[model samples]
Target chain A: MVLIGINEFIYVASILFLIGLLGVLLRRNTIVIFMSIELMLNAINLALVAFSRFNNSMDGSIFVFFIMTVAAAEVALGLAIIVMLYRQRQTILVNELKQLNG
Target chain B: MIDILFSIFASLVLLSALAVVLNRNAVNSAMFMIVSLVATAGLFILLEAYFLAILQILVYAGAVMVLFLFIIMLLDVDKGENFNFKTRKLSLCATILGVLLLLALILNSFSSNNLPSVELFLIEDSSFIDPGAFDNKAKAFGQLLFTKYMLPFQVIGFLLLVAMIGVIVISKKPKF
Candidate 1:
């Protein structure tokens, strides 16, 4: 039998990811949306680390390292874009910035 | 003992994540995000990834969250959008859908028959592992990173540089 303890980490990861997804879909605030994205990334990292631990390998952890680097870069660029967007539009609500719908 | 700790950290992570999503104040949400991230780092340590846990704290909780708070303060947002009756209904539907999805993942489909049965007791001790072991220790990570993953490591460095330049250009006030 597959022990419940073994798969519990995966379960938590899934829940965390779902919460992040809900955040992105429901929140109009751009900053909160960005935070949701970070939460999702952390969830994936948790699952990867769990898998690495179970498999007795280092590959997944290494992959997570790369993921963190990418996440850091993405956050810096995304926030910069948000700042620039705010400068041009003077608002950060997603719904209010539909000028490109044309 | 480890399982108990795991449950605590996981619950902490989920609750704070929910707070991050549901909170109206951007600053409060960012603070909750820090809590969620740090709790996730705790989970990493439970998984025996000490190096990753530290990186999670330093890079994610420390640097990334600070940047988020900085942007939030710089924007000086007056108030968050209110969830009217329509959004409340929409969120209700979304919550139902998400809960169903979680049930599908955790209940019927993810049984042991489909998964590779690795021994869970390997991490029971939760003590300091010897350096020679091929676990998630820092020494082993360095060896693997320097050997098979060297090219990708360099590529990630270049990607960071590119992202830095792009951010600088995008955020700068136009000279003209």
Candidate 2:
């Protein structure tokens, strides 16, 4: 049961992370990609808290808090950028935004 | 019992995640993302990190994702049919890499000999364990955040403030 505990949590976290990665890679819409990124962050948070619990320490939870803070800020800035891009191009398709390619 | 619950929550998280990715509309994707976040929060609770679980729901599912929905509604984007899952060569490569990574993680996890037992972490003190036991999680988390992790906590606050200012500066319409 001891080994199973760690294996279980790690398995869940890895699967979540993989799903998020697939979403990021395959999704065409910019907003969906952003959502996938959020999924990735949550997966890492799950892993962190799981490790912290396994070790009986509070440090991992603290790190999760900080990660959450950063994620919040990231969403704010990222969405603002998306809004601006929408205003300029009138489309949120990832492949169409090529103005910065020059 | 825990395994059953874990399986339920894991499937919910994964299925909602897939919906978020495969949904055609941006709004639907955001909604599915919120569901995935909430299910992930449930997993956090099962991990015994009650404080992180609450924060997960409040921050991710509540505030941040709400903002995503607000923006989606504000933009009033057409229900465009742009969602595509067509696999290219790169996707196949990514899939192969993902499978290899999963195999490596599982094998490596098995090789590790010092994995701690769940019983070791289970709350044994019935006196300290009650319906309100998790209520202390936030207080304990706060104490640590303010003491040992004070510098990093403050730094995160500052970072958030800076990001807020940057968003305003970037998004504000020019008057002149």
Candidate 3:
């Protein structure tokens, strides 16, 4: 029936991760970088679930909880930092954020 | 049966992922990211991880994406049309590099032998949730989370509390 095996999921995850990587490297918007980071995290989550199914273990699924928690924390802190930066700098563009580049 | 569903969701996830990167507007990127998230959650359901699927939709697509949109609107960050993230030459280089990396990953994947296991074995005495059943995945997930993974659960709770304080601290106006 469902023949999408474990490695296929991994391949999908890797491609998503690479896409996120490209976004991070090529896109200069801080928000886009944050979104890319989330994309990468989701890719890891996919791999974790796929492996859990393949191994018949619930441990991998449990890891997803931890990952999501950390991701939430990251987003909270990251957005706060962005907001703070915007208050000081007036723009969210990455190219203009060079005051601290000593 | 399930394969068809999986293929559909997987492609949608990838498509929305591309939208997240390629869309010029921050709001559009955030919305497409939510689409990608829900699709990935659907794939999780196809893997019989019903709890994770629900959690994915609820936590990520629901709570997290909302926060993203809130931040985007609060700052008025996308008022004007701005497009140049990098020079065209740099973007071209990045595209070529990313494609090369993808090709390498796909080619490398074909030659490897996959792990040889598929039978699900549940922890003994966890009676309510049958590991192989179509339903009750949440029970198994809760059982594991409450028992074997209790420490991490509590730890994550503490992490959330600290993160809340940190966010408030980071966003406050500096008193000079």
C-alpha RMSD values across all candidates: 3.7, 3.8, 3.1
Residue pairs with colliding backbones in model 3 are none
RMSD of 2: 3.8
Error of 2 at B1 (Å): 2.0
Reference-based lDDT, each prediction: 0.84, 0.79, 0.84
| TM-score-best of 1 and 2 | 1
Per residue, candidate 3 scores C-alpha lDDT tens digits across A1-102 of 446677678878988998898888888788888999999999999999888776666788888878998998999999999999888888888777778898
Order the candidate numbers by DockQ, best to worst: 1, 3, 2
Candidate 1 per-residue C-alpha lDDT over B78-171 given as tens digits, one digit per residue, 9 for 90 to 100: 4646651126777798889898988888674556465655665453322235422336557677877787898999999999999999999998
Q: Write the per-residue lDDT of candidate 3 for residues B2-64, one digit (tens) a residue.
A: 678878888998999999998899999999999999999998887878888889998999989
Q: Which lDDT tens digits does candidate 2 get at residues B10-104?
A: 89998998888778778888888988999998888787777777888899999999999988898776455444754487678768877888888
Worst 10 residues of 1 chain B by lDDT: B124-133
**Residue A47 lDDT, candidate 1, scale 0-100:** 90
